[model samples]
Target: MEHYLPSFHLKGKLAAVTGATRGIGKAIASAFAEAGADVLLISRTDSDLKEMKEELQQYGTNIYTVSGDVQHYDEIIEKIEQKKIESSIDIWVNNAGINIRSAAEDVTEEEWEQIISTNMKGAFFLTQYAARQMKEKGYGKIINISSVAGHVALRTGVVYAMTKAALIQMTKTLALEWGNHGIRINAIGPWYFPTTLTEKLLQDEEYVKDIVSRTPLRRIGKLPELAGTAVFLASEASDYITGQTIFVDGGMTIYGF
Candidate 1:
């Protein structure tokens, strides 16, 4: 029997992840580092970046940090350009997002704008910049972190679902346009992952039970489970796959009630 698992290794590759200060983003960054990829971590907080960089050093892969607000298109473009001068990006993860859970009738204009600008607008511009560079090289992977809410109407905010659904479409459109250029665009939709955003929900016994009951796995997702999906999408193992949203939801989306 011959072993052929080396294709999954990200050795010698340069990967970039936005929202990498904590939660799913941080997990993905660390997974890439452990797989031998030099990771560029982006976040709005300087302190978080410093802390993450220190924690990631154990993986032995070169780690770099960029502090910027992704909501500003110009800032993201500038940072992408600067990073490009250093190394060609092989994998780009658009993981920066925000959600304000409120009923549609209760959603304020300000809340709507903030969610759309950060989740959709920011990801779009960043993808444009990354895709341009990838087009030049004829090889790249772009991963957008979507959510299960996008697939079905969850009790979560409608604006969040809208943004994520848009992301799924964006992945498909870009993949079709750039497949000839050796670029593969894809998305990951996570459900009920333990993160700062869901800290409150996780603490509520009723909400937790409701979530687990719906999920076939009967439990909330682990952050590392999300990381494994990301690693698969970022590496050569998924070279033939593109434009698909892989839901890491523990069967929540598949279960019907």
Candidate 2:
């Protein structure tokens, strides 16, 4: 058991996390650092990236920051590849995502483009860039941060759900193609966590009560709970697992009963 337990540790690994300055991304980045991995935090905001780099330095792991936006994957990855860290990215987490909650009928082309480009298109290409680096090393772990709204029917953002669903499918498809290259791709389908994106919704008492009522665990998810799942998926412990979406939804995905 002692021999097997060490596989869960991410010591000496280099991980790149996009949208890593806040919420789920920050949690996952910190978890990687705590597990002994040097993290390359990516965010559109330079200030947030600088601040996050400082905060995670307490873990005694080397922390680096890059100002990049998921929507502009080409520019971002090009810069990353030119840097010294790109050649050895053992883990990559696609944690940058956005949600614009508008009704299907009221959804504008602008909203559609923003959500699709950021959540799905950007994630896929970023995974490709990271996978190429991993392909050279012949081993890697990729985790896509999806949502339960993509799995079950939710009366939330329709366009946001579409992108998430696409991400789930993208994880499966790439896992099959890249398995031989030793690149394992998977996804995390989170329900409701207290992210900056969900702050307003969580503030609504009726919304909170309704969400709790539908969840089998009778609660929303915790940050650590979700981060733990990310850690597991990114670790060698999940070596044989790929192309699967782990729903960290407080049993809400199975709450139809």
Q: Judged by lDDT, which candidate is best?
A: 1
Give the distance in Å from residue 89's predicted Cα in candidate 1 to where it truly belongs. Answer: 1.0
lDDT of 1 by residue, 1-257 (tens): 99876588999989999999989999999999999999989999999999999999998988988889888867867865776546778899999999999899999999999999999999988888888888889899999999998889898999999999999999999899999999999999999998998998899999999999999999999999999999999998999999999999999999979
What is the per-residue lDDT of model 2 for residues 1-257, given as tens digits with 9 covering 90 to 100? 34546478999899999999999999999999999999999989998988899999999988888887789999897777667663388999998999888989999999999999999888988988888889998999999999998898798889998888998999999999999999999999999999899999999999999999999899999999999999999898999999999999989998865
TM-score, one value per model: 0.96, 0.96
Clashing pairs in 1: none
TM-score of 1: 0.96
Candidate 2's C-alpha runs over 4 A off are 1-6
CA error at residue 14 for candidate 2, angstroms: 0.7
Total clashing pairs for each candidate: 0, 0
lDDT of each: 0.92, 0.91
Q: Which regions in candidate 1 have their CA more than 4 angstroms from the true location? A: 1-6, 83-85
